[model samples]
Target: MFRTVQDFIEDYRDESQNTLKLLNLLTDESLKSANTPGFRSLGHLAWHLVHDDAGMLRRIGLDFKAPPAGAEPPESAAAIAAAYRETAESMLEAASRWSDEKLLESHNMFGRNWQNGLTLLMFVKHEVHHRGQLTVLMRQAGLQTAGVYGPTKEEWEKMGMTAPK
Candidate 1:
């Protein structure tokens, strides 16, 4: 968990860039791909990441507002990337208004009080988890996967490098 607001902001900036790269690899057709019918599509997953960050901020008594209710998921990869960037910017801006003490203060989330730092960390982890899933789904749907933490499998092959040890 983050202890200082600066730590959260820096980490968020890095993670958000990675997310944007991943989104860039999506295709319009791939947005509808999912493991099964009724499961969340790639577009849905991306949209959720955008809204959920704002929701977590709200749960911590912040003024962050989620995307509009029933907003249709964007099919275009460009749109998804743009939305993620916008949300990340808003999150950082909101965080900038808080002090380190405020970040460490307790806030209620899901009926339990947690330090705001912890809640924010949880939100970041949650986004990463879903994003990892989306990357695999993207491959299965025949879309290219962009390098996030490091080079993706296909990327490594293209560079004449085997998977990292």
Candidate 2:
């Protein structure tokens, strides 16, 4: 969990950017992909990340605004990516007003009382979880996925190397 607002901000900035890269790579066609018949489509996962962050941050007392729950995914990938960018900036901007102590203060969110720092971390983890799902679905949709932490398999092969297990 974050101890300092700056620490969280720096991490959030990086994570959000990496997430946005994957979002930007999304195509309208690939958005329909899911791991199975009863699973969430890639667009749903992506839009959930964009909208759910608002609720998570608001619960942490950030006063951020994102799309309402159950909002339909935009018809275009660029629109979805743009919304994500806008909301992410708003969330960080609101979080910037918090002091370290405020950030660390415990609060009840999602039926649990935890420090705001942990809640922030949870929000990051939630997005990351869905981001991983989207990457898999993207590959299933015949889209080349970008590597979040290292070179993608395609990139690795291009370099005459293999991906680490």
| Predicted structure with the largest TM-score when compared to the true one | 2
For residue 61, model 2's alpha carbon misses the true position, in angstroms, by 1.1
Model 2, TM vs. native: 0.92
Task: RMSD for all candidates, in order, please.
Answer: 1.9, 1.7
Pull out the clashing pairs in model 1: none
Candidate 2: clashing residue pairs, number = 0
TM-score of each: 0.90, 0.92
lDDT of 2 by residue, 36-108 (tens): 8887888888888788644666766788768887789887788899999999898889888889998768888
Error (Å) of candidate 1 at residue 71 is 1.8
Off by over 4 Å in 2: none
Write model 1 residue lDDT over 1-165, tens digit each, in one string.
889999999999999888888887788888888887888988888777777644667877656445664688887878877877887888788888899998778877888888999998988899899889888888789888888878877889999989776
